[model samples]
Target: MERSLLTRTMARVPGPVTVVTTLDADGKPWGFTASSFSSVSLDPPLVSVCLDKGASTHAAFTTARHFLINVLAEEQHTVARRFATSGIDRFAAGDMETCELGLPGLHHTSVRVACSMHSIVDAGDHSILIGRVEEAFTSDRTPLVYYNRSFARPASNPDRAEQDIRASHIADW
Candidate 1:
């Protein structure tokens, strides 16, 4: 199968946007935007995020003892884009804060998962980093989603549409 076919198929599936952060050996913070994040094991509270082998932050994360997954809100598209960009300093803007675990985290996000590095697996062109959740925080804001190569939000009125259908059925009866 062609790579583009796989890419296109995956693009159709929406995913939550996140900023994965970790500290370097010298204590400098590093991060990258990712949509390839998901829960792994509930019993161990493990989560995984995939990083390209060539990503600038790959070395820092692979060696770090802990990392934070900052799940972006719908209002944080700019922050997501900034982290995804290459060659720019991601933490230079001071938009991040130090979590209780001493890792970097983004403010005003939907959720933050501070995790200790559990394991690493090499897959195709990327490396999967599994982390055991040590601490987690969540907000009321809705998550930012990525679909078809663009950001989106969950539909807000599905319940209303269902009510409308119900009302119509009642009228017909």
Candidate 2:
């Protein structure tokens, strides 16, 4: 029941990192690094992100009713760190532009997904915010991966696909 133990256990889980963004009333940008994101439905192009019950961004999220999911490029590690910390201006001195819907979306991301709130469900200590992707863009560039709590790049060789799978086998929880 210790919180540190819980954190350590969760840290062992390798998950892709994301920065969820929205605009405040004054049209300023806001974002936070999140690893708890997943595709919900393909037919509707839905995705989901979980937010801490007490996250400072929660109120803005509820009011904005719209946001974008920027799948980070590996080069965006600093962006991740910037948004993840508290009491920091996440978009300060940044080059992000407004989306078609006026939501703030980061440029040069692996992908930019503009969405509206589809629904919200309460979990144990978080809320699963489901979003209907109204639009999306995928960069021609490769994706940024995360594993064992670190950022990673593509394996590069498809001929080594078997080797990569085998390597993952040894590290299976």
For residues 75-154, could you state the per-residue lDDT of candidate 1 as single tens digits? 99999999999999988888898884898887789999999999999998899999999999999999999999999997
lDDT of 1: 0.94
- Model 2 whole-model lDDT (C-alpha atoms): 0.81
Name the Cα RMSD for model 1.
Answer: 4.6
Residue 40, model 2: Cα distance from true site in angstroms? 0.3
- Ten-residue segment with the worst summed lDDT in candidate 1? 98-107
Q: Which parts of model 2 are misplaced by more than 4 Å?
A: 1-6, 162-173
Per-model TM values vs. the true structure: 0.90, 0.83
Pairs that clash in candidate 1: none
lDDT of 2 by residue, 1-173 (tens): 99989888888776667899988778767788888888999997899988887888887876777889888887888877787899977788565778646777777888888889889888988888899999888887665666667777756787698888999999999
